[model samples]
Target: GSFWINAHIEAGKFLWQRSNKTLDSNTRLRTTGQPGDLDSPGDCLSLLVSEDDLEYYPGLPYNPHDCSDNQHYPLCERILQDTQQLLKDPLLVLEETISINIAKMENNVHLILDTIDKSISAH
Candidate 1:
């Protein structure tokens, strides 16, 4: 009965997916506020070689088949996907743990209730 955890996680993932799609669109991408300066935001994705020498900025990789049919730079899309999956995993683990604990509670339900009732009566 993880009503709170389950509902909240699903809603968050849904909202993130929708917002990410909107950001990937051309209208937004075109006016994405790219600067004409040398220190463009694009520079952030440049390869970090050996933590010292700043070498090749080879450019975004080929988009994978599963990515948004196009436009998604392979690495960026992967990072997004991985990040989404990583976020989902913890919720799944929490759900599984909740389920397991609930199952265990079933076996001890009577004993647990009795103990609670006894403690309350003594108080």
Candidate 2:
């Protein structure tokens, strides 16, 4: 059994998987072939190509393989020297900022709605 977590975590979320694959340089993974395979195993990730796929564009695509299986671990490059440094965690900081901004925006929207309701009652 082999498992490795790359330096792509944003908070608790995996930053590599996005709704829009173009946003990241990582290879987009192929969906599994089974029907309603939600409960199936193999949630852990891997980046390996089948021997037949060696001639393809980037060669390997990310996939969720059975965690108990052993595969060659991919060498991932770390962008920051010290991930423990708060200032160095760009993804975490950005995610936190976005969350704070969204909360403020929601509060503003609620205030605006209340003001509108009061104006209508006065009218």
The candidate scoring highest on lDDT is 2
- Segments of candidate 2 deviating more than 4 angstroms: 1-88
Model 1 agreement with the true structure over 1-123: per-residue lDDT tens digits: 000101001211211232332122112122122323222221212112232222222222111122222322222222345677899999999999999999888869978999999999999
Task: State candidate 2's TM-score.
Answer: 0.33
- What tens digits encode model 2's per-residue C-alpha lDDT throughout 1-123? 222334233322234432312213232443333322321322345554555444452433544444344464544532332434656578788999999999999999999999999999999
Displacement of residue 3 (Cα, Å) in model 1 is 39
Model 2 residue 83 CA deviation (Å) reads: 5.8
* Candidate 2, poorest ten consecutive residues by summed lDDT: 18-27
Worst 10 residues of 1 by lDDT: 1-10
